[model samples]
Target: MLCVVYKSPNKEGAYLYLERRDDFRQVPTALLDTFGKPQLITVLNLAKREHLAQIDIHKLQAALKTQGFYLQLPPPPENLLAQHKASLQNDKG
Candidate 1:
């Protein structure tokens, strides 16, 4: 299923990952403005690092508001494999 992933605009806006494509399509421009792009990037990195299936946008936003940072989800399995291959090559060098 396709999902809508976006950043919130409010102060320390958190990353939002909507399961429904419609929700993603419906994101208000004003909301995006409130959540700065940088903050959204941070959240995306976190979700990617942690390997989260579905992150709670509201919780992430709240954490960002209070802590200024959040844990990243782990990289996807494919990415992990690629990283491992790169590391092996580097070690050979």
Candidate 2:
């Protein structure tokens, strides 16, 4: 399967994948509004790829098949303070 990827202009590290290039018929208007204007990224052949850097290939494919689109959100920021506290507790035990 082939997909077109678009980066969100308002969001960093957010991407939208569609089964067809520039086709947003299947996507909801509210989602599109929040996603902001999409900037062209690339066209990808899912069949040729075994893995994706941020998204799971299988899950992406499934979403495309069922929903005609997939939204990739950036991972949550790591909390260093929480990690440090956990480490201190561990050291005391």
Candidate 3:
């Protein structure tokens, strides 16, 4: 199936994949408010197996099938800096 991907301007690294590029009317108002204006990213073909960086093809397919869209949120930071800082503080103490 072909899917249209939209990137959220308000939230960095957030994406919305939908069946129809122009059909966003079904998306909830609350979600839209948080999502902000969606910028057209790319159109992709969803096969059984494919190379997707942040999302699983099966999961994406299921979401698009059930909810008419799939939302991808950014992954959390590694937080190595915080751990390093804590270790430094412990050493100082």
Q: Which runs of model 2 end up more than 4 angstroms from their true locations?
A: none
lDDT for each of the candidates?
Answer: 0.47, 0.96, 0.89
Q: Better model by lDDT, 1 or 3?
A: 3
Model 2, 1-93: lDDT tens digits are 999999999889999999999999999999899999899999999999999998999999999999999999999999999999999999999
TM-score of structure candidate 1? 0.26
lDDT of 1 by residue, 24-68 (tens): 333456654554552323214434443345556556555455543
Model 3 superposed RMSD (Cα)? 2.8
Report the CA-based lDDT of candidate 3 relative to the real structure.
0.89
Clashing pairs in model 2, backbone N/Cα/C closer than 3 A:
none
Highest TM-score, which number?
A: 2
Question: For model 3, how many clashes?
Answer: 0
TM-score of each: 0.26, 0.95, 0.81
**Total clashes, candidate 2?**
0
